[model samples]
Target chain A: MSRPRVIARLDIKGPNLIKGVHLEGVRVVGDPNEYALQYYEEGADELLYIDAVASLYGRNNLTEVVHHTTKNIFIPLTVGGGIRSVKDVELLLKSGADKVAINTAAVQNESIISEVSRAFGNQCTVIQIDAKKKNDKTWEVYVDGGREKTGIDVLEWAQTACELGAGEILLTSIDQEGTRRGMDIELIDAVAKMVNIPVIASGGVGKIKHIKEAFINASADAVAVADLLHFKRAKLSEIHPYLISEGIQTRKVLGK
Target chain B: MTLNAKTISILDYGIGNLLSVQRALDAVGASWTMVKTPEEVKLSDKLILPGVGAFMHCANTLEAAGLNEAIIEHANSGKALLGICVGMQLLFDYGLEQGRCDGLGLISGYIDKIPDQQDDGSARKIPHIGWSELFLDEECPLFHNFSHIPAAYFVHSYMVIPEHSNHVIARCNYEGADITCGVQKENIFGLQFHPEKSAQAGLEILSNFDSRI
Candidate 1:
């Protein structure tokens, strides 16, 4: 098995990176490229970019962003939001993204998952799921960046996505997002168990303990940090060391 | 633009990440071009075949565009040909992907799924999507004088099984399974791991390739 990955998530709104709570009340953070480069230099394993309003606007403007970032950063780049078809995936891949995550469009048309898998191999196809806790045992799937409720069970959708050939799942908790607290360990645990593909736990990572819990308790293969990284609550460089201190096996780049 | 000195020609079959490859080449201070036409592929000296999807899609596109012949000719001419990931898989004789897909057959072997069970009968991920430490064969010229790293980035479900054991140059131990990740036969080289995304060490590998062959 590969080591657990630490990824930096940047939510893009037009040309700027933004921060949102519960996937709402958005505010600009800074230049996404700058933060991405910083995270890469700080020993981050991967970087992800999700267009904040691409699904609502039915357009993704991340090509230039990805193009500019990959110039120096030589890690895997996974882009999400408004990716509805194979053409969209090709555009992102051509723009230097190693993988792509689909959510809103996948909910509307489930076949896109398999389609992308066949067109670009399962390794590059990622299914992004936005979830909100429905109760203690279940979570509802939300779309359009957590704005629309699909009434779909989170566990079931994850399994379906996996069966449909999605290589990885980017599971974001709507309730815990941008909370500056801990992640929804129960939610992540449930979905991570439901899918065989790698699950990237996103939302509500404020400190090192939250990250450790997500990895150890939730069995998350990777954790995508946003608020914790963007708010300067912790340095991207320090998180991995803390994880290592706890005997967690995370990826380490050479001479970093 | 003049083809003054044989530049690094990357065969773009509309299925691979040519940009990142080009960027890696540029970073290594090697002049490269995204060769999309069969004519251009035939005219190239140092050719790179890149694929990043289902074997059937990539194989079909390569054959349909008549680029496969150009690639074979380039390889047969004793020119150095590098294949990346799915491109490397295509160098084999057959692929057990959806059905039995014909490959370029530059090397004898089959591409099969990594299997649900490892050597110890333990379960592992199907896609095998992450970085794994590389165990390279020192005699192989591909890694000569190259900087060793912690690991190279890997993301694939299938493993290449070359018919000739001598062709295997590097292997990674995954779940007690010593899977082949790099292979070489004279001027033809194949790497299952994506060096373009493996950080600086990866860039150095590309640089080494540029100067070596």
Candidate 2:
């Protein structure tokens, strides 16, 4: 059976890796490549580097970071933020990103999803949805680092993006993000059921059990953790083993 | 034991993630280079064909770049050649993606989309993206260091069904079926997964390939 991917999401600001609460009050952590290599060595299934300030800056600045880090880290590297065009996607891929996630640009021009997927394969294009609950069952989509409300229904946008040839969805919950409260199970379940492609549940993971819950309860294909890993509160080595003990298939843990 | 002097040429036929494969080779301490021209492909001791995208487009690009003939000649000369993902699919008789597209015909097989639903009547994800354990159906030099079944990362919607079962070197269980993951016939090898992104076990596999050449 295929195992749920454990991805370490490193939010970048300039050259340093940063962490924030609900995507605010950002604080610098350490070198991005340092954390990335450590995670790769500790058995992370994949690494996601999101430039938290890229959208605001109007250009991607993580290309050099990705190119440098990928030389040492062999696992799949996913880079997102400020990916506004097919040329941007081409630049990041040339810089060694296995996949490029588009959040703001995808919402603005849904055609970019199909454009990137057509130029590259669907596997290369990822649709990232920053969602916040608007009601009991409805979630509103936000863009521009979760600052602007697109007024688009989360499920509707996800389904449309998939129809536009998105191979995967990276669903982030604004309410649960950086809270350590755990993933939005309802949101994940809703989107996973709505789309045929794999959905990666991100935000609000406090412990290893939360990761397992994202997989078992929400049927998420992968879980992306940021605060827990960036803060050194949990290690992937222990997390993978704990998940394995719970009968969750995972990539074999390596190193000490 | 070092491959310092020997540079394994990774064919850049205008598609696929070649950097990850290059990093994997670097991790194994093997020298490598990216080759696009026919002369570069002919000069390398070993070649790696890595690709991603539509099969018809990839096949057509390879043919237009004259990489098809160069790759076939390289394989026929008994030099080691490896294909990953769509590159592996391009080694077969033909691909049914987009339309019926002819492959390099390095091996007898056809590429087709994986079944959408399993026998259990449950919906199976279109692109089988994630890590899965590989069961060695037949021993091959590519997996020499692995003491047991190792999981590798896979991201694809289509699968290669070789003409001869003996060519299948490894299989992985997906949904309710055992899908072919690796194929080996003579010096030519094909892997449907991204071993470069598969962590340490994948590094071992790349090291094995490097050592064999």
- lDDT of candidate 2 over A147-168, digit per residue (tens): 8999899999999999999999
Native-referenced Cα lDDT, model 1: 0.87
Which candidate has the top score in TM-score?
A: 2
Cα deviation of B134 in candidate 2 (Å)? 0.5
Indicate the residue-level lDDT of A204 in model 2: 96
Clash pairs detected, candidate 2: none
lDDT of 1 by residue, A1-256 (tens): 5778889999999889999999999999999989998888887888999998899999989999999999988889999989988999988988899999999999899999999887788899999999999889899999998999998999999999999999999999998999878999999999887777789999999887899999999989899999888888898778877897898877655445
Stretches of candidate 1 off by over 4 Å are: B1-6, B119-122
Native interface contacts kept by each candidate, as a fraction: 0.60, 0.71
Worst 10 residues of 2 chain B by lDDT: B1-10
For model 2, what TM-score does chain A reach? 0.98
lDDT of 1 by residue, B1-213 (tens): 334345888887777888889888888899888778878887787888888878888899899998888888888999889999999999999998888999999999989988877767656777887767788887776787766554788898888989999999888876566789999989999999898888776787788788877
lDDT tens digits by residue: candidate 2, B41-74: 8787888999898899999998899878889999
